[model samples]
Structure formats: C-alpha cells, structure tokens
Target: MGAYISTFPTGFAGLIPTALQKLLPGAQVVQVYDGLVHYRYGGKPGDLGKVFLFHNTFLVLREFQGPASQMDSMVRSAAGIKSLPPSRGSFRVRYSVKNQFVAVPKERTRQLEGKIAALTHAKVDRVSPDTEYWFLQRSEGVGFFCRLLGRRQATERDLHPGELRPELAYLMASLAKLGRDSVVLDPFAGYGAIPKQVLGYFPYAMVLVSDLDRDRAVDLRASLGGKRGVSVAQRDALTLEGIPGATVDAIITDPPWGYYEEIEDIQVFYRGMFASFRRVLKPRGQVVLLSARKREAEAAAQEMGFPLRQRYDTLVNGKKAAVYLLEVGPAL
Candidate 1:
C-alpha cells in the first residue's frame, strides 16, 4: 500500500474519506485538511468521482513557514523522487492554502511554478495541470504533496447549467453501497449527471433516467447511448410512470432547487417526488437526493412514510444544500 491524497469541495470534507472507505473497504483514511484525505492503499485513483485529484504521495511535509522557502524545499523534495529528473520535464503544481490564509500571497503560484522549472531544470508545461506537486496548509504548518494530480473536471462529459459536481455524485453513489447488477433510477435527470456517475462507478443491472424537458430527454439518451441495460425517457420527476414498484434497487437523483430551476411550487414538487420515490423503489432500496429544500424534503418524507437513513448538510458553490439518503420500508 502507498500513501495518497484526494481532494473534495469545501462543504464536502467527509466525502473523500467515505468514498475511499467504500471503494476499498477496511482501508485506513485520515483527513489532513479542509478537503483532503490521506489513505494507505494499493488502489489506483480510478472509481473516484468526487475525488478531484490524487497522487502517489511522494513526500509528506509537516510544516511550511512561507511560500518562497517552502517552494525551495518542495523543489528539493521533487529532486529526490526517482523519476522526476531530466530538468525541463513538463509538470504542474497545486498550492491549497488554508481558508484563514486566503490572502497570503498573490505571486505564490507563479513563484512556485518558476522554482520547479529552475530546480528540476525541467521545462514547465502546464497544459495538463497534472499536479506534479501539491502544497497544503495543515494545522501544524504548510506541507507539500510532492507527487500529486490536480483539477480533474472532465470526468463528466455532459455539462449543464447546474450539473452535479463529480465529488458529490461519487459520494452519493458510494453512500448507496450498492452491489453488482443493482437497478438504479434518476428522476430529475439533468444532463444525466447523476445517472452517468452511478453507471460510471457501479456495475448495475439497469439504469433508468427521465427528465421533464424534451431536450434533456434527447441529451440523456445520447449520454447513456450504447451502455448496456439503460433506459431514457421524457417525463416529470414527480410522476415516474410505468416504472414497476418494488423493482428498482435505488433512486439517485438531483432535484431542481429554487436557485437554478424555476419551479412554481417547491414544496409541492418535493412532496410529489417523495411519493414517486416511495412507489418505484423496492424494499431496502435507497434514494440519494441533492437539494437545498431540506424542510420541504424532510416534511414530504415524513408524510410519505419513507425512512430517512442519513442527511449531509453541505454547500454547492457557497449556497446551502444537502444530500438526503433515504430507504424504502423493509419487506415483511
């Protein structure tokens, strides 16, 4: 097992660790920063949707006083790596300064980049941003993730106005704890983001998707094209007609909230969605939903008699949002 680091969004501090734990059960995961996790495992950095970037964790520093000196030390650390030689080697660097030190230095990024080029005698070609080096501010001091990969956003092919971030999507899927050949559904299939993520990570029996918009239906069909056992259609989330009850293994969805989507009645929509979920999901099946309307969803769940398994309060682009994981009533 090797040391590695993973990154998630600010509000999702716990998502990365949970993903690592689920993906590689019994793996030891420790959080070292706001959105960072260090784990010792032999797993390659695949199957991680919510994880932005990960590295082999070449060097682990416990302190950093300032950028200039820290960059010097990082360059020296890079020099010691087995394969980092041949100055002019194309590379990238990521500095994750703590929130409290947001205004530490403006030229820090540039200086660090230059130092890497000068010390390694390698040409710095940042076209890839592969995170050749990682510097993070820990509680004790600033540390460096000498060998790192950073800023991995293309994991999702289809993009929309309010697409679910990769980390959140992965986290939701991981939390479901589904196994091979499980059936999954996404009611509000915007750009098919949640469905695509679930499909990408898990080997499911079937993936059903629907959207209220015609264009979205077409887009979802295209996005899920050629994938085995996938179905796409145009339909309102509040009414997922024709999906047989007690057949679905899980319902993973991202409902439209007030900020980005224009809904006439948010509460009514939430209530209707809860009803739909209860209908389609089989016994012991889970529903992972992303929404900002917590009270509405909670009230609907209570009224609908669906069991709330867990809820994570977090932010999406600074706006208050949450991930709700609910379960169907167990079969008698």
Candidate 2:
C-alpha cells in the first residue's frame, strides 16, 4: 500500500474520506484536515484521478512534524525518499505554505535539487519537469513531502463568469444520492456544469438541462445534446416550462446569487423557484444546490416546506458558499 494526499475545497473535507472509500473499496482514511485528506490504498495510485472532489493528488514520500529548521533533514532521512524510482528526465520542486501556493525560495529549491541529484543522478528542469515535487508546510509545523501524481489537462471549453468548478459540481451531484434509473435536472444550467458532472460520475437514466438565456441554451445543446439521454432547453427555471409535475428525481443547480443579475428579493425569487421544484419533483424527491445567499435560501426552502436534510459550507472561487440538500416534505 502507498500513502496518498489529496487537496479539496475548504469546508468539504469531511466528504473526501467517503468519496475515496467509494472510489477504492480498501482505502483507509488516515487523516482529514480543512482542505486536505490523507489515505492509504492498495490499488494503482494513478486510478485516484477518478475522484472528482480532489483538485490535486500526490504520493506522500514523507510526513513530519517539528520546527521549520528540521524540514531538510526530514526529507533526506525519510525512508520513502530513499527509493529513487526512475524518472523520465528532469525534476522540479514547489512549495505550499499555510495552504497558500508560493514560489519556492531559490536557496531552498537549489538545495532540494542537489539532494535529488545526489540520490537519483537526475538533472533539474524548473520550467517543465517530467517529475515535480511539492513540499507543503502547515501552520503548526507539520510538513508533507509529496510527488505530484496526475496533472489536470486543459479542456476546450472556456470558463464563463461565476462558473462553478467541476470539482464542486461533482460534489453537489453526489449529494443528490440518485439511483441508476433516476432522472436528474439542472434548472439553471449555465454551461451545464452540474448536469455534465451528473452525467459523467453519477448513475442516471436521463438528464435535463435548461437556461433562461437563448445563447447559453444553444451552447448547451451544441455541447451536450449529442450525448445519449440528454435534453437541453431554453426556458425559465422558475416556471420549468414543459416538464410535468412529480417527474424529476432530483434538482441540482447553482442558482443566481444576485451578483451578475439583480434579484430584488432573493426570498421571493426562491419562493417562485421552490414552487416549480415542488410541482416537478417526485414525492420525497431531493434538491441539492449551491448558494451564497444562505439565509434567504434556507428561509425560503423552509417557508415552502422543503425540510433541509444536510448542508455543507464551502468556498467557490474564494467566495463563501454552501451546498444544501433539501427534501420534499408535507408542505411541498
């Protein structure tokens, strides 16, 4: 087995352990911090790329806790570091201090490069190395020496304003707890992030995505309509245009947060949204959504009789937000 570390969005750390366990049946969660999770797995380390919540995954070469002065010695003496596996060509080192990405000091970078060269006879390539290592230093003097496992490849789609990250999109989709035959919907499908995640990771019979903007709807159809069992439409989510009542299994979306557009009264807007949610969702169906307008969302859901099942406070693009799981109740 090998020790591995994964970084996720803050406040959703608790979800990582379960996600890893589901991905790898024999995985054991060693620790869970604010935005990081450490686990041990017997399977191929590269397979960890399947985890959607993880922004990055690394193989832990060493873990230590002591004064900052001991970091160099800790790296040199670490048993895991002594096994100098063959590298493609060159290597480079990076640093993360107190959860913030920072440039490695020239002296420290050179020192680490020299140590690696002495151990493995490899040269240093700072710009584009075949292998990269990250040394993360925590606030309490804890340190983790990690080797990057998989790099995120760029996609063809350009990110739009206020777009939800794919990692967070998968997180919200997982909250829905849908079945293989369930039909899912994204009412406000801006670029279809949530619907795309649901289709990619979760089991669902069909996916319905709609947006109020005609241009975005065309884009969604062009990008997503070719897929099997995907339905794209240009319609106001508050009214849910042609969808019948009590049909959808779950509604997962990132509604307007009164930022790009003006929402005179968020509560009133949510009430209208919930009215459609009540009509379209099957009995006991669920609604999992992300919103920065917490008070208004919870208040409106409660007022509309959708009992809150669970809520995860997290950050989206450095902005405070929360994911709420609400279930249809008697009031609905």
Candidate 3:
C-alpha cells in the first residue's frame, strides 16, 4: 500500500520523517517531490486524526503545461531532496486541464476525476466510487496520486491567543505524531496549540499544558474543555516541577526564539529549560523543539546530556524555522 506525506516549506519537511518514523515506523519512504512524498505501507493507512495518530502530509497534485519528466527533474533539484529515498517504480499518475487562475475550480476537479477513470481502465461512472486518487496542489501546478483517500477537515482560520499561525499548530501535531494512548506535554504552551493538536488525535491521553501567561492558560482551558484529558496551569518555564515526576511521554514545543530579544538572556533560558525537561520527562520520552537559534538549543541539550537526534528547516510565518528532535542521554 502507498501513503502520501505533505510538508510546509523548509523545516516542514523534517516534521514528515519524524511523524513517519513514529506512525509508519518500518515503512519505506518510496518517493518524494516538492510538497509531496509517498510511503510504502503493508497495512491500511492509520487514522491520522483519530485512532492511529500521524502527521497530516498533504497529497498535492499540480497541473503543468510541460511534461511530467520536466516537473520531476525540477523538483529533484530543490534543496531538501536529500531527505527522501530514491524513486524507482511505475505508479499511476493523474492530471486535469482547466483555467489555472481561480482556486480549486469544480470544472477542473471533475475533469481530473475523469482522468483517474481513464488511467485505471474503469468507466466514468465508477470514478466517484474509486477509493484511489489523492489530490494536492500549489500555486503553479496540480498533481494526483492513485491511492486510498481520506479527507481532512478544512483548516480553521480563527487563531487562538498567542498562536503565531495555523501552520505552527500543524507542525506541532505532525511532530508529536499524537495518537491514541500517546501522552503529550507542552511546557511553553502558548494558547495551547501544541497540546490542542495532540489531544485532537489522542483524546484519552492526558495532556499537560502550562504557560507563564495566566490569561492564555485560561484561554487554553476554555478552548479544550471536554475534548481531551487536559490539565492546564499558570507557571513559568523555570518553575515547572509542580507537575509530577516522569509524567510526560513526548514534548512538542516552540519555545520563544528571542527574535525580538524579549528573552533577555538566551543562555539562561536554555539552561533552565534543559533542567526542567530532564526532570519531568520519562527515560524514553522525546522532545521536538522548533527554534531559530539552533546552536543555542544544540549546546544546551549537549550540556544536559540530551542527544540531538535530527534537525530540519521550514518556514514558519514566512520566517525560517529550525526543528530539532532530542532524546535523553546516550540511548538513541
């Protein structure tokens, strides 16, 4: 079986591998290009937002005036191409023709549906019934992949307090691979976007969300009530031991990057955070952090015996963001 993986710009691609590793574990990543990647899985695709939690990787289908080989080659030349495994297979491809100006035109959408029928040698009436045909798009082109399809809810536009953007929520959810029985923690839970996404997947797992801002903490509590097993507290990051020991399983946090120099002393903040993370995390718990200053995070983690597992770059709110995965000392 095949599955599609989508990522945002830069470090977004990094989120995909971590999510894939956690959810699809041993599955091979078979192909990748631009905004889309394919994974080979033996079992049915897991419930991404409900049961088997995994990141939402978009299946973008672009329509180009040029040949498919040209599109493939152009994508191969992009910077993050190295993250994907080499491509070698004859998979079915789908394309549609229409005015490429307006967004997701229904006429074009129908035309694409007809193409899938022709490719599979199925009749036009059977196209709608087919379980295959994954759809994705960008500004310049559209692409279609034939595979099992699942529709995601339209992305929410309203921003919660302190949420930088919707993409950050997506990134956090993708990084944690939040699913059933997965406990998630966000020490710097600004408006609780990270915990919110985690609970979206595993409603049963206890989510611990804390923030320095009391009002934001209150907002998060109101936003997540009765949706998941949630606990919210107003506390500074330096003083987070109020929570019980070894209580959290995974952490997906975007700490203050100090871009505006709001964090007066960056090193001190890192030192305190490292200590706090070590105190609360279980031996096998993983930390996925997004920061602009990679060196600071890397140095602090090293000093505190947290091994840096991997790093990726992605654009967050049009700014370059670095994402890192850290595991407790000397194990992985």
lDDT tens readout by residue for model 1, 69-162: 3544644554444444333447766555453323324365566667667766666665764336655655435555445533465544444568
Put down candidate 2 lDDT per residue, 1-332, tens digits, no spaces: 99988888888776777777876678899988888888898888767877756777889878877874245555455433556555657888877778777774577567778877777677889898888888887766677887888755423244777677887887788888878889999989998889888888789998999999899899999999999889999999889989999999999999998876888988899989999899999999999989999999999999998999998998777678899999988853
Leading candidate by lDDT:
2
What's the C-alpha lDDT at position 282 in model 3? 81
Tens-digit lDDT track for model 3 on 68-161? 3233322322212223222222222232223122234455545554444444444443334434333333334434332434443333345543
The better candidate by lDDT, 2 or 3, is 2
Task: Give per-model TM-scores.
Answer: 0.72, 0.85, 0.59
**Full ranking by TM-score:** 2, 1, 3
The CA-based lDDT of model 3 is what?
A: 0.58
Q: What is the alpha-carbon lDDT for the whole of candidate 2?
A: 0.83
Q: Answer with 2 or 3, whichever has the higher TM-score.
A: 2
Per-residue lDDT of 85 in model 2? 55
